[model samples]
Every structure is written in structure tokens, then in C-alpha cells.
Target: MGNKILVVDDEENIVKLVSYNLEQEGYEIITANEGKEALAKIEQENPDLMILDLMLPKVDGFDICRKVRKDGNTNNLPIIILSAKEEEIDKILGLELGADDYVTKPFSPRELIARVKAVLRRVDYTADEEKQEVLKTGAVELDLKKHQVRINDKEINLTPKEFELLSILIKHPGQVFSRDNLLGEIWDYNYHGDTRTVDVHVRRLRKKISEYSEQKHIITVRGVGYKFKED
Candidate 1:
């Protein structure tokens, strides 16, 4: 079997359909029909990825996403939200809470599988890369191996996505990156036309880092994209 995947949906048919398709691809599948069960399975199975549905009994997908990201044990776990809600706010909320990707209901199984593969590929690539011990710029310091970031010697917590975004910009100062470019680099997939994801993340990243440093590290290029401050 390949990587283990957890499928959490209240609909039995949806669960069966997804499990069948994933199993055919040689992945081990663990399933839960409700939010609470999903959380439990995550701890016991330690799946490489999770397909989470928003509407579920007891706990909800948003809360689960928050919890998973907050917990040190599963903070780095990859989550893909599978929901029927088409509201832009819902999508933004899920992403803000730390979901790696979002898929609406009535989705193509092939596309979903492709997203799964892309996400796993990014994860493997990050893990396999040879990185310097630490990256330093101004007051910001990033420990690549430890996955820790500190500003002026004071550590701040950042989600995996935020950390990756900062790492990319700080590595290449003065290079402007369009929203599309950032979406491709950080998300590791074409996010259709949702550039707002990049904006939301940048806003949050700025807010977090701003608390510690007076100088702005990430700069908006007005109509363009963004760039890191150079010396």
C-alpha cells in the first residue's frame, strides 16, 4: 500500500466512492462519517493526507482544521476541504484556518486525485530538499531544519503555509512575485483564479511578523505582486 489517507464525510456513498478510487491508486484508506470520529482516526492512523467535509455531526471541519494546525503532533498534517458550500467566505475561512486546498461537491474524482498527488509531491519535495541550517535577514531568522522562525530572538508561531511563504520571499530579496506566481509556488497547484488566497495569507503573515519588527519585510508592489525588502 502507498500513503495512508483519511476520508471524512457524513455521506456513506461519498465515502465509499472516494475510498474505492483512492484504494485503486494503491493508497491505504481510513474513513470516518462524522467529525469526532475523523479526529480520532487522525490520531490513531496518522494519515499522510486528509479529505475533510464541512458538514458533519458533532464537531465541524473548520474546528477540526484549527485543532489539527494548533496541535504540535499534527501541526504539519496536510488537509484538503471537501464541502458543498460554494460561498467565497467559506473557502476563505477554511484556508485561513489552515486547510491546504478546497474542493466543492460534485467534483471530478480525477481532479481530486490530481490535487492529492500534487500536495503529496510538494510535501515530499520539501522534506527531501537540502536546506541551509538557518536563514537570516534583518531581525527575522528562519531555522529550516527545525521549522522555526524568530524575530529579534523572539520566536513566533506560524502555520506551515505562512512559513513556506516567508521562506520563499526572504530567500530572494527584491524579486517581485505576482499573486499567480505565489499561488503556484506556495500552494504547488494552479488554484484556478483564486488569487485572494495569496492576499489573505500575506495579510496574515504581515500581521504576525509586524508585531515583532518595525520595518516591513514583505512589500506590496501596488498593481504587481510582492517582494522582500532589500538591505
Candidate 2:
């Protein structure tokens, strides 16, 4: 079966455009006009990934994200927030709410596709036999072979990008990886489109790990990249 993607948006045109682009790339598309319907589809369809709209009707994107995270069944599902809210706070709030990624409106179809492909590629589940590497930092645990990561034994349902980003840091422990290096390793992007993309993902990653530590799990280097902190 083609990868199923649930698109939640109040804009019909945006849905049509995104659905069309995603379909062209051989992905299965499921759509919703509001957050309420989006949650219903999320429960009924269990899409591999979701494209959520922040300014959704009725329930709103943040509410939907918070709800999904509350439900254990759909908690691990990857969410990409697609909204016109380009402000830094809006972006941070979305990521903090457990979204896997965020894309502002007026996005280029090509860039959007690239971003989608990048997210999907990271989430492509590894085979059962591949679950052999176990890396841990403090109370957090990452089993590379099992594709499982947990904090205090409570599994953190991280998207592929988050997994890769964390794995890179945890495997090394103290080595700080610059943002550019992280972009290359995680997103495989060579250019400097938005360096903040790495920063946003790092913030989300840190939040996911912080459930185990009150201080922080990932440490930031003021002028450089990021590193994993065991203490």
C-alpha cells in the first residue's frame, strides 16, 4: 500500500493542491477540512503521517496535536504543521506541541515535496532484524535496531527525523554537531535554506527527551550545533 498521508486544512484549494502534489508522488492522500474531522480520520485511518493546518476550523491545529499526543494509540504518528503562521513563536509552539515538522504557507510545491519526501524517508520503518543498536544517555534510551526510543521507559514516539537527529547525538554523547552538519545528516540537505530548521527540530527533540530530565537532555552550543548530555 502507498504511504497514507492525512491532510488537514481549512482551505480547500490548499488541500487540493497538496493532495495533487502528494498523489503525483505515489502517496495515498486522505483529507479533512477541520481539526475535528482530522482526529476522526487519524483514529480511523491511522495514516503514516499527517499534514496539519494551524488555523483549522473548530478544534484548531494545536488542540488536535495535543489530543493526539494524549492518545497512546496515535501518539507516535508523525505530524507536519502546514500553516501561514511564519512567526517564530507560532513555529515553536507547534513543535513544542509534539509536531514532527512545520512548514509555512506559500510554500513551493517542489520544496514541500522535498520536505515530505525527507520526512517519509526518515520514517520508513526498519526491518525487525535491524533492531540491534542500543544507545542511551541518562534516562533516555534508543534502540536503533528496534526503532524504539524511550524516556524513563515511557516510549517517545519520535518521527524519523527526530530519531535520526537524536541517534546522531546520542551515539557520540559529547560531540557537538553544528547545525549545518545536522542538516546534512538528518535532512540530507546540502544548502542553507533555513538553518533554523535544525534549531526547531532540536527544540522538539529536547522537549521529547526532557520528560526524563528537568535540566535538559540535549545541550546547545551558543555558536555551534548541539550535543547529547548524559548528566
Who wins the lDDT comparison?
A: 1
Error of 2 at 200 (Å): 3.7
lDDT for each of the candidates? 0.87, 0.82
Q: For residues 55-87, what per-residue lDDT tens digits would candidate 2 score against the true structure?
A: 988899999989997787887688888999989
Candidate 2: clashing pairs of residues: 130-145, 131-145, 131-146, 132-145
Task: Provide TM-scores for the models.
Answer: 0.92, 0.86
Provide the clashing-pair count of each candidate structure: 0, 4
| Candidate 2 Cα errors over 4 Å, as ranges | 125-129, 151-160, 190-193, 214-217
Please report, as a residue range, the 10-residue window in candidate 1 with the lowest summed lDDT.
124-133
Pairs of residues at least 3 apart in sequence or in different chains that clash in candidate 1: none
Residue 204 displacement (Å), model 1: 2.4
